[model samples]
Target: MAVYEKVKRAIEQMVGDKSSEFKVCVEDTRGTLGGILIKIEDVKTQEISAFRINEGDEGEAEHMTMYSVDTMLQRRKAEGIARLEEIERVLGIKFEKWQREYILSRGLGYPIGGRRTGRTLAHQVKTLMKSKDDIIIYPNQRWTYLDEPERMRNSERYAQGYVKKLRELSEKLRNHGINVPRVIEVDDPQAEFLTKRMNLPARRGDGMR
Candidate 1:
């Protein structure tokens, strides 16, 4: 069977009867400027058509679609980095690579901030380290090697440094073009005005600044 046909059939099966009202078209050879040329819509005469075309035996349609999707995701990630840069520029701060990776890998959603579950950043990080044997905090970012209760206070210093670094990093990220909350006064502010004044949204749709 033709490659386009195979892909089209596979897509149809995956979509199942959910596409009853829509038509899918498949072209034997389809090429789009940016990606695959696949359309899902309604067909006349109470029928649905699902059409897909192949640019060649290579299943260019599917390949193009995948490529487009990957490209979009890459663009988003770049935008995120850019935003981080803007944050730094605006906040006069810098972020280590390890810290950036940690935030991104967490998938903790945009507008990243320190962990806020009543547990301190140090505690959470320590817990993560204990649970995941493979985790290694990078050299640029300090980590606590807490094995004894007696060392708690000393280990906590590491946590304090991390918190300070993260705040600086977050600011740097905002300056990098990532839309982040407008940094107000960096010095101590009134406690009552702290949350209310800076509660504005930081992240944009594309993670852009």
Candidate 2:
């Protein structure tokens, strides 16, 4: 059996009788790095067509390299040193390899000051509202939020940030003569929003205060 036929049949079996009104197309792509592209779609509704492609598989993944702990650590250290050297060379700023300092990482959600993407909040909102695609991918966007205890502080800060963003967006729209909500309401504006302790992620980063 051909590779494409095998993949198509496997998908059909996975979907069972539901795939009766659907089509799965697979094509072998040629080049230096060869692979197959698989596309699946519903023939009736054409609502969703999720497709995926595979690049070249160089070797048997089951026998992939598993380096020793010592070797892995050494390799990581070397890579870090090389990166620091490259940064210093580009910026002409010296960094002592041994000297390290911890800084509170505030860059969790949005880009700092929203200056990185160059795409303004207004533009983003307009684009989102105008988009009619069945599937829209959000890069650097998180779907689920993990709210934590009041002591953790990361959780409630996001809500506050969200309010701030809404206010900013409203102001931007108002500037463009687009009347949006004048007031954005929320529960407990000043208090520390609390959550159950069981949901805490098992992370040891900087020791949660």
Q: On residues 50-151, what C-alpha lDDT tens digit does candidate 2 reach at each position?
A: 333444431211111111222333453464455434433543555332221111111222223333342233222322222222211111111111122232
Winning candidate number (lDDT): 1
State residue 199's C-alpha deviation in candidate 2, in Å.
65
lDDT of each: 0.39, 0.35
- Sequence-dependent TM-score of model 2: 0.22
Give candidate 1 misplaced runs (Cα > 4 Å): 1-36, 39-52, 55-58, 106-178, 181-209
Tell me the lDDT of candidate 2.
0.35
Using TM-score as the measure, which candidate wins? 1
Each prediction's number of clashing residue pairs: 37, 0
| Clash-forming residue pairs, model 2 | none
TM-score of 1: 0.33
